[model samples]
Target: MLRMLKKMDGVILFVLLLLMVMSVFTVYSAIQSDPKLGNHHIKTLQFYGIGFVALIGIGLVNYKLYIQYAFYIYGFGIVLLILVNFIGGTINNANGWIKINDYLSFQPAELFKMILILFLAHVLVKRKNSTLHFWKDIVPIGLWTFVPFALVMIQNDLGNALGYIVILVAVLWIGNIKLSHALIALAIVGVTFFGFVKAYTSYHDEIFTFLEKANREHWAERIDPWLVPDKATSKASWHTKNAGLAIGSGGITGKGYMQGTSVQSGRVPYTYSDSIFVVIAEEFGFVGGSVLLLMYFILIHRMVLIALQCRDRAGPVVIVGIIGMLLYQVFENIGAFLGLMPLTGITLPFISYGGTSLLINMACIGLVMSIKLYGQEDEDELLMGEQRPTLLERLWSMVKKEKTTA
Candidate 1:
């Protein structure tokens, strides 16, 4: 097992560990000022430890078993998403979570993202070269992606829905999709988005009128605050404003742990959870933020390297999909906090305090490790050779041969 892990991607594991540690420190700072939530920090650390164990355990299991169960897992995941729409608890305005009594809750969508990756890997591995012509061969792939997207959207969890789509695009691109197909898909998305904007403009009066009728003042206020921040003073904009202030106050080196006024004063909403990164930025400063960003870059970079080293297409697809999910969520969470993007309640992967997300993220790492443990290296090198050219390739092949044999 040690030999196998060594053969796998060490850089990714190192980066993940660094980020996990960072999360504990940051989460501690975020909650330390509040006596009501003082003990929450300790509880979060325990969850992280448990998640680490699960990640290692999963890594030890054969990745092939996951492939075998891809369809069933995907089916179950979709069903969970569907169930959550009716039975799920509301967080903010989005109804996307399921409460498991007082201490634990689960997001079916989080579980679904992992399953979708597995299913995509299974489909792509079987479809093989057929994926060359994107649309011609990738409609089935789109179906696999969209079913979850539609379900999550119905749950009104746009952030997670978008996360799912982003993962699909990343896996599809890495799976050897045609460049033209990618462009065409992008074109379609642009056009659809444009149409949505136009429709919103034309129906603006009607929507505003309906907002009054429904008395959804909280939900209705988002558009105005987002559109014109200075003019919007409602609760909808308060989270965004306070988050920005916390990040801005951090300056260069930060104010020191537990020294942030807004964080300590509890000015920033969701500081210990969805917007935890802001607290880290405030107290630790830009230096700390840069370190956190570096950790993410390393984790992503290592995951990509692992995918490239995968014995088969499935491993690469799985790894890339997970990479996409993390990248999207990180960008959404941090971007919104820093006022770079819209407020989209997406958790900051392992850093955010959520049991379901932490478990799923660790489970994702486990699968990547599993691929490393049981995966064949020779097959990937051969595939890599096929993508290149020449008789020196034979010489190059002999070198790889020696390396594998050695």
Candidate 2:
């Protein structure tokens, strides 16, 4: 065990520790600012403890074991998502959480993200040599991706649904699909997105009327705040407005710990979860926030390095999916805080105070560590020319060959 520990990636481990320390401090400040939150930092500490255990436990296991049972794990995730729809408690109008008790809830979507990565890595690596055709290859991959995506969408969880989309794109890109096929797919997506935006902007009333008639008023309610903020008085828009205020107020050095007016006044909703970035920025200022972002950059860089050193296709594919997941969440959450993107209620991976998200993220790091520890040397090492003979040995071999020829 100590030997394995010694072999683990130190840079990734250091980044994880740095992020955890920051999370503890930031979560404590966030809870302290609001009297109603009631010492949530204690719970956050417990989660970190649990998450660290999971990280170490999974890191010690062979990552290829996950690849072998990838389908089974994915199936289990699907079942959980389906079950959550029927028995889950609603939070913020999304029925995506399974209540465990009065103070605990489990989000299947969080676990599903990891499972999707595993399954896709397994399937894509298995089909590495298969010819790429839309109907034959791409369609099956799309269907596999869309199943969990549609299930999450049904729960009105657009954030996680979008996360699934990112994972799919990452896996497909790394899976070595034909270049021409990938270009065509990208073109179709681009055209579709452009068409939707044009139609929404040019025919707002007609489109809204259609949405109302089709019983998609919820979608309208969520989108309207972003598209027409001047007239939006909804709670979602209110949250975004305050989030922006909190971020903008924090200039360079921040207002000091637990001293944010917006946070203390309880104006920013979801301070410890979705709006945690706002809390960090408001209290720690631009420097602190930049430090956090630097940690994330280092974490992602280390993961990419591990992926590159992997001996097999599965290791790199799995890491790429993880990279996609983290990148999207970070981009979406921070973008929403700055009002550059619509609020998507996605947690900021390690720093956010969510048990399920933190645990799953730690598990992902463990997987990467496993690849680094167990996977063989780079294929380039094997591809290098056979060991060269010493100068004397080479000369002796040449003399022997000449004698034979004579």
Candidate 3:
């Protein structure tokens, strides 16, 4: 156990601890002004304890075991998603949560993020050396991605559906897809997105009418405010407007801890969850937010380093999928907070006050840690073998010999 602890990625563990500590402090501040949510920070702390255990426990297990059981994990996630559609309760007008009781409910979509990554890594590693064909290679992977994506969309959780898409794209990028084929697909998506935007801007009224007829008025409501700033004062745009204001108000140093007027006044909805970034920005200002961003930068950088060092295809592929998940969440959450993108309700990974997201993210980190600890052994042997060393290996050996001589 002690040896394993020494082998763990210290940088990642530190970042996770820092984020959890910040979560407790920020959540406390965000909830202090509200009588009803006074104890929410306590729950956040409890979740942190649970997340810590999950992180270490999952890290101790061999990640190959997970790859072996990838299908079962993916199927279980699908079952949970299907169960939510049938018997789940609604929160924030989205039927994505499954209530186990009055006090306990979880968003299965969060768990699905990790499961999808595992499944993709398994499939991609299996087909790593196979010939890439649009029909034979890509379609099966697309079908795997589409199932959970369609299920999540059915639950009206567009933000998480987008997350699934990000994971798929990331895996496919490293999954041996042909460069020209990937470029062609990206070009098609780009053109389609531009065409949709042009049509919407040119004929918004017609688009709105069609959306209303199609029972997607909620999407229209979200799009309208982005299209016309004048409409931002509407109920649908209330959260975005307030979030932007809170972030802008904290210019440099901020108003100080627990001193945010918008947060105290309850103007920004979901301050402890989706809008937690607003709370941190409003209280700690741009400096604090930048510090948090720097932490994430280090975390992602370490993960990428591990991916590069991994000797096996599955290890690196899994890390890429995780990187995709974290990157998309950070970008989408902060973009929505700044009104640069539509409000997606995606929580900031560790800093947000959600048990499910926090736990799942920690588990993903645990998987990365497992790869770091176990995956490097084989590579180290190869590096120090009796064969003629490459330039890089010779340099590495010299460094090691110097340290030993010292």
Candidate 4:
């Protein structure tokens, strides 16, 4: 246990702590004028407490164990998702959550993100770092990813659904996907997206009416602001419009903490949850948002270093998949509010206030930490090639050396 604790990455842990501070404060400010949210800042602290336990506890375990049973874990995840489809209650119009009595309901889709990462890595690692075969390797991976993607979409959770493809593309890239195959897939996706947007705008009413009849009108609400803001109803565009205005209002320095006019006045909804980025932007300005992103950059940079330094093939594959999961969530969450993308249920990775999302993300980091601790066959290999010290190893070595000198 002490050994695993010693292996923990100090830089990443420190960044998580900083984010916890930011999440708690921002959630507090976001809920100040909204009475229903009710002490979400306190709840944020409690969730972080549990999340730290998950982080360190999972980090202490060998990550390879996850890969070993990846299929079974995936089966379990599928069971949960399927179960939710039947017994799950709706939240925010998405019937993707299962209730555990009144005070404890969880989202299966959130947990499945990590499961699919492990499962996909397990599949990719079987190629032994060789070029993946088009039919045998690539097709199987796509099928596996698509199954969960379809399931999540069935529940109307577009944010989590998009994540499966992102994870698939990432693992395939690292898994030695053929350049020719990659280019073809890329072209298909580009054409599909462009055509969808053009069609969506051209036949707005026709498509929206179809969606409305199918009980998915919210889909139209999400896309209209991004694709054709001019045509979006005030009701459909209000969230992104006010969010953008509030963010722009912050200027360089911001309106001061907890002083966001739009936020306190209830112009933007979900500020305490998915729109939490608005609070940080409105209260602290571009400087604050930049600082938060800088921390995220450092966190990702450190994990990428860990992946690059790992001696095991599977170690890097798992890390890459996890990286994809996180990068998509962070980018999409912030992008939706900026009107650069359609709104979805995705939220800022660590800075958002949700028990399930925060804990699952912390566990993903734990999986990364596990790779750093156990992925190597020996301590000597912890250094990056030959004798060059990795950033993690150098920082850790200095800390230990200072203790020895003392």
Best model per TM-score:
4
Worst 10 residues of 1 by lDDT: 380-389
Off by over 4 Å in 3: 213-215, 231-233, 377-406
Tens-place lDDT per residue, model 4, 1-406, is 8867987899999999999999999999999887877878999999999999999999988887777778899999999999999999999989999898777679999999999999988777666678988888888888998999999999999999999989899988888888999999999999999999889989999999999999999999989999988888999999999999999999998999989999999899999889989989999999999999999999999999999889877788888888888889889989998877799979899988899999999999999999999877642321222334567998999999999999
Q: 92-151, model 1: which lDDT tens digit per residue?
A: 777888999987788898888888888887777766555465455578778878889999
The sequence of per-residue lDDT tens digits that candidate 3 reaches over residues 1-406 is 8799788999999998899889999999888767888887889889988987888888888787788778898999999999999988888757899887777789999999999999987777666456568888788889999999999988878899999999999988888889899999899999998898788878877877897797777776766667665643488788888888999999898889999999988999889998999998998899999999999999999999999998877889899999999999999999876767777779999998888898999999999999987776553322222244577999999999999999
Stretches off by above 4 angstroms in model 4 are 378-406
Candidate 4 lDDT score at position 179: 94
Better of 2 and 3 by lDDT: 3
Candidate 3 backbone collisions, by pair: none
lDDT (Cα, 0-100) at 97 in candidate 1: 88
Please write out the lDDT profile of model 2 over residues 1-406, one tens digit for every residue.
9999999999888888888888888888778756777767778889888988898899899887787778899999999999998999888767999999898999999999999999888777666446556787789988999999999999988899999999999988888788998888899999998797677667777877897797666665656566667545565477888888888899998998989999878898778888889888998899989999999999999999988888777889999999999999999999876766677779999988898899999999889888898777542211231233567998999999999999
The root-mean-square deviation over C-alpha atoms between each candidate and the true structure, in angstroms, is 7.7, 9.1, 8.4, 8.2
* TM-score to true structure, per model: 0.86, 0.88, 0.90, 0.92
Model 2 off-target regions past 4 Å? 129-131, 205-218, 234-236, 377-406
Pairs of residues clashing in candidate 4: none
Poorly placed runs, candidate 1 (over 4 Å): 1-8, 132-136, 194-205, 210-224, 230-233, 377-406
lDDT of each: 0.79, 0.84, 0.86, 0.89
**How much does candidate 3 score in TM-score?**
0.90
